[model samples]
Target: MLRRGMILVFSVLLLLSGSMTVFAAGKTGEGATPSGIPLAGLEAFVDNYVKEYIGQKTVGASVVMVKDGQVVLSKGYGFADVEQQIPVSPDTVMEWGSISKLAVWTSVIQLAEQGKLDLNQDIRSYLPPDFLTRLKYSEPVTMLNLMNHNAGFEEYMFDMAYQSPEEVQSLEAGLRLAQPAQIFRPGEVVAYSNYGNSLAAYIVELISGQPYHDYVQEHIFEPLGMQDSIAYSVVEDRPELLEHKAKGYFFEEEGSFTQGSWNYMSMYPNGGNNGTAEDLAKFAMAFMPAAGEQSPLFEKPETLENMLARSYSTAEGMPGIAHGFWEYPGTLRTLGHGGNTIAFATNLQIVPEDRFAVIIMTNQAGESNIVHGLTKEIVGMRELTETVDLPDTSEVQGEFMAARRPGYGFMKLFPYLTLMKLKPQGENQLQVSLAGMTGSYQQVEPYLYQKVGGDSALDVWPMLYAKMGDGKVEAISVYTSDYLPLPAGRTMPVLIINAVLAVLAVAYFIISPFVLLVQAVLKKRRASRHSVSGAGSRRLVTCLSLTGTGIVANNLILALRMLSNNERAYSEVYPQLVINYVLTGLAVLFVAALLISWTSKRSALTVRDKRAAILPIVMIAVLAGLLVFWQFYS
Candidate 1:
């Protein structure tokens, strides 16, 4: 009776709290899997680490660790569906996010092995003529450019994903809709491009005379027996798999969580794999070929070896890309990819030399701890060979902006706002801050810095390659993207100045109406002599004030709408752009009127009469200048 009463009390509290959590039962993968590795402690370690974050940071999570061609650990925790009180099991499928790119890369290699695809030849040779409409340079983009993520395409911000599964478009149509301009020349400026990866997938479709998914189903998934996985936006083709899929969630606080919409992508190859933890373990095991055995994913053992070889590096003795896999900091050479969807997160890492691997998946929106933190602990710290005579990091101390950001339009401001600040932490070390994730790095080589410690974001990006120019750092490369020096207009001081000016302008506009009302009432009460300030001046102030307020209102409305939605297709972005253009035109007209008034010099406007008009004019003009400098109008 006591135990039952206690359980009832716990249930009532759970209802009151709203963030339902159950100590979800777990299940092990069924197989005659062997475990010769000294990784027995890993299962307990993962459980302890995961228990801390299950209710606080993530609703449910699945973890699988493998070593020496055997399953070290595979388990699930917490609730897959909190409202339904359904406990997550080993078979509970979750989105694989960018880890889906592994399949695309694998397919690329399979064709290359077959002598059907050229890694060095121009990708344009394979695509239909004029398929690329936004080239800025005449240089050829090769398959390597896509793999290394230096194809120079700008980050396409919208229509790559939709909220509704019904909105899924064909792969070709999705590519056409979100194709970004070639912002940089080919073979330079490494930026993580989703469009580039999907384009590669499309190339697979064109070359094989089959859809990319079908090709994957035959070449990669079927060989590894990853039957529980689907790489498209929705699993309509596999209803049973979809039924087992865990619903994604967004955690607000301790005991508060909201369901998140599934991210339906037409550019699905970039980040759309959904599967069970056990099945992903099977996929991960493909990379670790046992002695006298060949990887089933590749036709030849040499082909798999070549695919894992270093494909790109920003500096010598630094972690880089092995074909499509980003190198991870580990005791040995660890290579794999991490992924994120709207609400699901996953990571797959393998130490090929050690034949060890780890996979973590969670149904948490923009997850951190499990996918990054737990993985880091699993793939222990790499022993540095350059411990003695470490290089100094003085030249790299400054604010920088990531290269993996929209290089066009108003959305460009986002990269600036999340600027990375690197400052001296101690001798031979520097503290790094970007996007609310902070960490410290010690210079192991002249241009290479390894992450000593940080939050999950830094864990996700553990090593950096800094380029020195003259006396300062030119760029800092981290996995798929690089961080370049912040332009003068994008510096923190300049942004603060812009913000202070905008606040003053909005504050002025907000209060100006009350002032005008008082003046009207007084004028009605008593007809005084002709006012000192000219009607032209009053009209200018009132018009500029109204325009400024309107711009602010429009921005707030758009932001609120976007933030409130679980999915973002950016269908409304075009209309918002039109509104911005109209407001910009009004601003231009105001500038013209003010310029014409000043040039005419028909009246000697003084402080008592003209100062009020000048304040708004100065404020708005400076704000406009800053916006133009930051490419907000583009």
Candidate 2:
């Protein structure tokens, strides 16, 4: 059945791609091609492209461009729900993936500015003993290391922990696993570490003695008047507050929309947060303080300057890390982070020096790259003093449904499968009662779904459904959950295997150094037995050298894997998926390197040569087994 579904998904993808090509070809002549473009021409070009090209595309998106502290253009494009023909709006709330990192960083910096926290202080000083146990080095890891990504922690560890319950027994359990060896000394070169950010959040929570979400809301969000924004998992049960929440979509294939899961996890500070594009604009504006008064949230010039300063370089040879944001080198000096989950992708770029910024939120996955391109284009065009009218969406009509069924066949099964009871209360209004929860939804026209109930069980009820014809309705989409914790009663074998692998990895790191030292001593003793120029002695030396190099390489790889795995354990608490992929890729690379070294030693060799080869080979095999176990059977 899964295979059939896979085939069906692939077929739909091909159709969508083919259709997009045809559509793009048909609209090729809708705008003028300007040669030797001026700012006016650029503005005209961008407006036409967004409205005629991107706006007509299937997915929903919001774009806001600011220049010199003023909003030059802010518009919504496409349908929040295509089946209901709902047009996107600037007020639509979106799950802005990793962009949430900036929010976390902002809150932390606020504490630092208040002299309540210190960037140079060791994180272990703030965290509990259990959390401290997971760290690798004897020396302290400072807040600066965490912010600059110089802590040498694995990016995948945090992601995995956020997604898999068994991988991370608790927040404390995940932290305990972080105590591996450091990849590099603190304040060396920068490496992107989601785990580092997550740990930073944990440190903030420890120091403030507040829940991570509460600290950010009280200090940063509320002060900025970003009332619409909330930590992602906190608002799940309150559909009313989420009435304007935009539906998130994932591509069955490239450029095709399909329902995707909502990411609900406890790691809200790291990357699990949601807000409206308008609110995001306000947040960006705060970065550019007005002439007379200071920002209510951050009143100091030095505070703002420190936040925007480039702290580290990224692998791309660009200025990578700022205090709580990313910096790109150029006259513009943009700072931002792009976020993605299964369903949504978002970006918030700020040019503090020019007092310009762009906030882009898209319901569609895989659309962030395109949105970033469009944002850059719009920013360049803002120099022009031209107006571009938004497209109208008054003609779209109909009820939004959740699914399509084969006529009577679905009605027969509906009673058995339907988890929520829904009834139509008035024109374009629905009263939904589910799991002892009741809420109302009113169709606001052109595909927007709004909750209008005066009294409801949910604090925020943002349910939008699209009628898919033939008596089936699809629920409106929202944020995707990172990894739903398994039911308490269910046993997770995969977690057990991961724990075992983690133990073995620890054992290898602990024992490999001692083994290498003993081998070195033995080699010195053997050197005295024969002339160093003999062919036999030369072969022995060659074998020993290769073996030593392989061992060192294997141990280095294991150490990295261990640290990354620890990060994955915590990442299960967040909603980012990129970290998981990175972790998997690194695990594969580690194993491959070990295998290559092992294969190179299979030829005829002396006892000393074999011993050198055997240790690394054994370590590699154990690590491979562990990874396989964790990936599949675990």
Candidate 3:
């Protein structure tokens, strides 16, 4: 009860602080206008962009643009169902993915307005008493924390969403299974979390005394007149709606397209709405007041105002998270969210000051840049106004790990696994190599850099470096309007050497059995002069062969299982763990045998042979150590 009272006070502080921040950020006139590019010629530019994308064989896409509470453009490009040759249109239904989080967030605001929910109260107050048993931090997880994406839940991977409705579990069941232990104290650093959003929606369900689906239908969709939209918990539950849904596709290696499987959401509110571009644009309109008319969807204008305000941000002013929206921090001051599921990508962006909004939906996954490009064209986002001066970055050269504070035992090896190289370009600029792509950044402040090249709106994109007490660079967090901090790990050198050696060892192991067989055939056919070897050496050779083969086989099985049935494969973690231990034991045995052969008097090996055996022994030992570090044998 005391905790509840404290939270209520905290909630009031957030409101007061939010209003101050908005005032400080200033009103419409204070911010920069849309890029100087004329809005008149933007339609043709977008049409040409979509045509080029279609020429590249993009499966399908729907785009809607609105300005001043009026629909400016609404159209689709390419085939919705390639095999059936169905053309997509503005009304084509597509899974909105994480963009659906907006509905969940808006519903929360509705309840808050009605005094049915408290943003500051402990989430446990709304959940079943025994629902969440693991708590790693002393601080309570509040609704505001969830909204800010600072709830401290570890990244959830297993059984997140499914391909079929039959495979999905109830929301309570999925939460119970996927619920992660708290890693940081609530309201710590930001880490985007789907589980956090789902939990918030579940809280909405409890307070409103209605199922989550029904509540959103009656309150949001119906009120917005979005007849084509449905926030479904299970994908296959609505077959009639499914008929209008655009089939999602993926590009293949042969330059062909393969239809992706349907995604049945387990965490419904995280990314589960399916709708048309026109319908979503309607919902986006409700967020802005039209001609002195307040939103029918929101109870009060103040609530809408607060929802659109900057709720949480880092010190350097990178818009971190705003209520349910992911701020596209730029000169335009846009509020939006990008969503990606199994095969579809969706983006909804709104520039409230201009009363302009856009929703882009695609049948292909990972096309966020396409939507961003469209927005940039429409707004004519400007280039950097002023280039901030920088300090010397001579000492800041090295590899940086994409920092993730793993809360679960299985994720202990996370820090040592991610890698990024910061190569010094000049005195004030550096190039970042991440996942085979290079991004050039110019130092703006003492420790921050803004990415160069691309739309001018992204000039505000910040890459901040945190230093240790002794003044050495400690960790680097890049702001893409979303915070991702990657700290330097000490294991890079060791991991690099180990990775090279392991690759060589696995390659030799795979080819050795076949090579031996071919050699035996050659010896028999050619009538070899020298016999093979002594009994003890031959036995040792056989043992090493079997162990290497087993290692290769185990990896193949796990990979195949993951591709066939991901959820089932996840449940096989214990089995994989057991296999790892068994393999480690086998590695130790092979090493012992090699030692015994090289040292014992009974061994009949030559000096060169003994030295040759050391390579495999070293290889196995390195692998064994890696397994131990990874807790693979635990």
Per-residue lDDT over 5-78 for candidate 3, one digit per residue giving the tens place of the 0 to 100 score: 99767543332221110111123223222554344544555666766456254667787767666676676776
Candidate 1 at 239: error in angstroms?
Answer: 1.9
Q: Kindly indicate the candidate among 2 and 3 with the higher lDDT.
A: 3
Instruction: Report the Cα lDDT for candidate 1.
Output: 0.78
Point out the higher-scoring one by lDDT: 1 or 2.
Answer: 1
Please list all clashing residue pairs in model 3, or write none if there are none. 403-486
RMSD of each: 4.5, 23.5, 11.8
Query: Scored by Cα lDDT, where does model 3 land?
Result: 0.68
TM-score, one value per model: 0.89, 0.53, 0.82
Point to the candidate with the largest TM-score. 1
Question: Candidate 2's residue-wise lDDT over 1-634, tens digit each?
Answer: 9999997675444322211111122223332211222323434444455543343343767766555555555666666665554556766677777787777788778889989889988876777665644345566788887777667553333333243222223333334454333544565434455556667777777778886777877877788788888855434545754776767675554345666545544455566677877688878888888666576668587788778877754232223567767653323566777777546777777777666676778887656334655554433311212223411222122222112111121121221222344556665556655445666755444333344553332312222323223433323321110011222322246445555665665576466667657856787778644334233433433343343344334434544554333333433322222333344455445445434544564433345544544554455456545534333111
With a 3 Å backbone cut-off (N, CA, C), the pairs that clash in candidate 1 are 409-634
Q: What lDDT score belongs to each candidate, Candidate 1 first?
A: 0.78, 0.53, 0.68
Q: Which ten residues in a row have the lowest lDDT in candidate 3?
A: 17-26
Worst 10 residues of 1 by lDDT: 27-36
In model 3, the Cα lDDT at residue 627 comes to 55
